[model samples]
Target: MTNLTIIQQSPDPEQVAERSRTRRSIADKIRGMGQNRIGALLLLLATVVAILWANFATASYEAFWETHLTIGVGDLQLDFTLHAIVNDALMAIFFFTVGLEVRREFAIGELTSWSRALVPVIAAVAGLALPALLFVLVAMGSGYKNAWGIVISTDTAFLVGALALIGPRVPGRLRVFLLALAVVDDIGALSIIAIVYTANFTPLPLAVAAVGLVGVYFTRYLPSGRGPVYATLSIIVWLAFLASGVHPTLAGVAIALLVPVYRPDRRDVEHALELARTFRQSPNSEYARAAANSLRESISINERLQSAYAPYVAYVILPLFALANAGVVLSPEVLQGAVVSSLTWGIVAGLVAGKLIGVFGSAALMKITGMGEFGPGLTLDRIAGGAALCGIGFTISLFIVDLAIDDPLAQNEARVGVLAASVIAFILATIIFRISDAMHTDVDPGQTLLRPVDPKRDHIFGSPDAPFTIVEYGDFQCGFCLKASGSIHEVYEELGDRLRYVWRHAPLTQYHPNALAGAEASEAASLQGRFFEFERGLFTDQEHQRPSDIVRLARDLGLDVDRFERDLTAPEVTGRVQDDMLDAEAMGITSVPTLFVNGRRHTGPYDAQSLIRALSEGPPEATPEPQHPGG
Candidate 1:
């Protein structure tokens, strides 16, 4: 019997309930981590703490990391300094998480589609190449040429945090662009670490590691509760890679690549549904409980494992990594010498000047050559700003520096360059983005904090838990919304269930007098499961929008006419409609049919292709600060 079938046959109610609760807890935790702010804050705090500890409590900082730790059985043994453990072991988890993310992107995210992936891919390449070239030019023959990889990596946490600090004027598309670019940049960085930084290769262990990786790939078909097996195999792979002289962290990437992505199979889903139907008939049966458990297991192992591990890596491992690696003893004399050193200047130049030229220049080239263009809502000015922000290469840069340069003094100087460049990049990027913001449309300061879509409350047309969500705040009577509705419909038709389309009323009471009534009508129809029908009808027949016509449309759509009429003026319905308007207004949405695809604003033309293309690349829209009437 299939594991899920066996699971569904479980007799224990307590076990089923407990498992459900655990799953929900994991889902909640994953959602929290996805928001990015808390982890960013933690990383920043860790870096600051490390810097302070390094400069002030130098001896203790050094001693704590130097404390050796050993683990083994009998003659087989392994030893590591605390710092090495943090760097090599803890960072493996971090890289594994990164690998999962990269795999996801490649498998199903923006990177899956060439149309969406090209710009970011080009930009990432340019971003990496330019930084390296600049570093070489600046540091060549200056005893720091080996450290060029330091400037090549982008600190995703810092870049994201910096963007968050910039607030809502930063278009959602820019975040996506930067994120995709960083992911590609990461792959490049890790590859460099694997190939360029390897000291030597032991053939036997390398072959054994390859075998372990192959074994790991086949484990996907293995039965459930094989955690110990997977964990043991992973460690074996890691240690083998270590002995083979490749950066052991690449083993994380190798393992992640092998983890099967969990797209629900049609046959499995159908079987689960059949089991669920049977469970409904015998609700109290052990078989029913087992069926529920089976359904849950149908979710991919990769997704479950990634969720379970992501928070630990982000909040704990990464922060510890920052604490261990970011610490550089910056004494006055050391600082003075670092400033004069070409290593510092090379890093600074590579990070700031190289990133700017590379990212912006490549993007401009794409636009000029008709090769590719930025995603919707990403302007060149904003891209320039993003390019500037790319210079904040803090974490990975330091990791590379540690691996590339052996001399302690030289490492400190490179660290100095990294620190100075990060500060400079943040400042310069802020100014550029702010200016871009001012030059563009007047943005409400409240739009900085983007709100999350609550599937529980929001009326979604597709799967409520779809990976990409498009929320439109539109007024039925607005002509622009009418046009936008057609494009939105086209997008829904093309993307199918992969896209969740949510409609929120943003009735322009000042202009469209019938908009409020229209919104209420839609909400009222929603009471009878006719929300989308009413919405589609309204958009299709713009002229038939009065209260009487809405009632007729609801009737035609087979909604309970009496109930629809009664609910049209219901307080809750009115409140729901009003709430949507309030949300739109708070977000500084001054116009009709403002769209947020996966939380990012779609500021491009209201065409089907543009809207579809934008949503295809995921980014959340900035949330506006909610305000009541004069509250």
Candidate 2:
């Protein structure tokens, strides 16, 4: 009886619901923060404060940033002004996060293949070249034609934040496209900074920096103490770059590129799970430590470092950089000079007009030539708006102004241009997006399925000639979908051959980062004639749909793992998932676990009883005719 009493009772349903709601609220807040909206606002506020301080207390504003600080150990010493510290040291970390993103995207994210990479790559190159060209064309007489680098790169944080603030109807695909383009743009900018901007090249320190980068690369193999090893090596590389007269910030990029990034390994995750079970049963410190280490090791260090550093880079370093660098005395005389200044107008035109024309024009040309294509729902008008937003070149634009221009007054003019261009770009993008949304309202509003059931294309269970059909649009990471899966199983059991169930992909990527990947993985499995088997495995272990987990599931299902891996990124497989997403978008189906009975959308509860009742009602009257594949 005492042993029975020791057993844990099931949690109260109300408590469970309340806890779930709390978790969702927390998750939503975290997602919002991840979107960089708060960070962008803070950056804007910092710029305003800097401008006001520069205007009101010019002496103090300049003095505070210029105040010198020294650090030494024995005979060796280094000295820097407060401004240099912020620009050189703090900004290195910022660049490191960018490098991590570049590495991840190239490795496993959107830019993994040439086909997937072409659209952004072409657009980014044009975006970079056109801005610089326009700047040179405008600033030639200003004797700052060489300062073309100022407008060549987009501030991704601001771009994303601005897009969020604009509140586009469906921004997911466009956002992904813009981020990919930004990554390429960053690579180009970093290259220019290293080559074109580096006036002095000291071979010895650069050699030392290479050695340090090599050391950092090998640190991945270190069984333990990898973190400290990476930190020490990174510092050495940074100091080497500083000594070599190649910007120390590039050291961040170099080190980050060398860091290993990959999806979690199945073996490591299994080991972590085992340790977790042990810790749960024994409740001991040894098992706890082992479990934690295993869990950490399962995820690549690149991803871990990104999670650790991204928030600081976004919320703290960027805003601080703005506060340090954006100070400019905007007196009437200065403002009047800026109004007629060719250098100022050059930056304005290059960023606002050049970026808009370059990115959109290149993408349009690519689409016309069949060289590349935009993702579904990312129409030309939307692309134009995103390109306009890319013109918000605030952070890197100002950084380059300091590097390219020597005169304080000239820097002020350039700063004024960047500020004005960003504002104009924001307003322009907002108007464009609003107009685009107004022009492209959904026709059916998700009342009925957009695509009819094609047994050849869609994954289906039971007979194709079944009298009742239930189609579900779901994300693997959605808890509601997981619950609905249970209800769906019960309905399948009750109805059997009478019901033909279809599974469609509708991954809520903003909330569930792994959902799209999971959808693709299922499609990959479908290529091997094991779609339902993989689907069952995914629904059963919805919490573990990482790349490694998906691979392991494929192996467990007796599918050809190599083929499955190959198919996972195959164009057709990805396109299939994208098709479902496109249909979902067209039909205005935003939420997951959405069910369609026959050809009509099912509303209300999705329990087994409710689903069965809906299925029995048959197809609704005047349902939209499903189009043929590719129609």
Taking all chains together, each candidate's TM-score versus the true structure is: 0.68, 0.83
**Candidate 1 stretches greater than 4 Å from native:** 1-34, 167-170, 266-292, 442-631
lDDT, candidate 1, 368-393, per-residue tens: 78786443346788889999999988
User: Where does candidate 2 have its weakest 10-residue lDDT segment?
Assistant: 20-29
lDDT of 2: 0.82
RMSD of each: 16.2, 8.9
lDDT of each: 0.75, 0.82
Give the Cα RMSD of candidate 1. 16.2
- Can you write out model 2's per-residue Cα lDDT over 1-631, one digit (the tens) per residue? 0011111233234322321110121112125435489889989999999999999999999999999999999889999999999999999999999999999888877687687789999999999999999999998999899899999999988998888889467676677789889999999999998888886788899999999888998888889988888989999999999999999999999989988898765467678888999999999889999999999998899999999998898889999999998988899989999999999999999999999999999999988888875555667889999999989999989888888899999999999999999999999999999998888665444677767898877788988877778888887877777776677777778767777889988777766767878898999888889988888898888788877788889999999998887787676787668667766765667576677887888765556765665666543343322222110
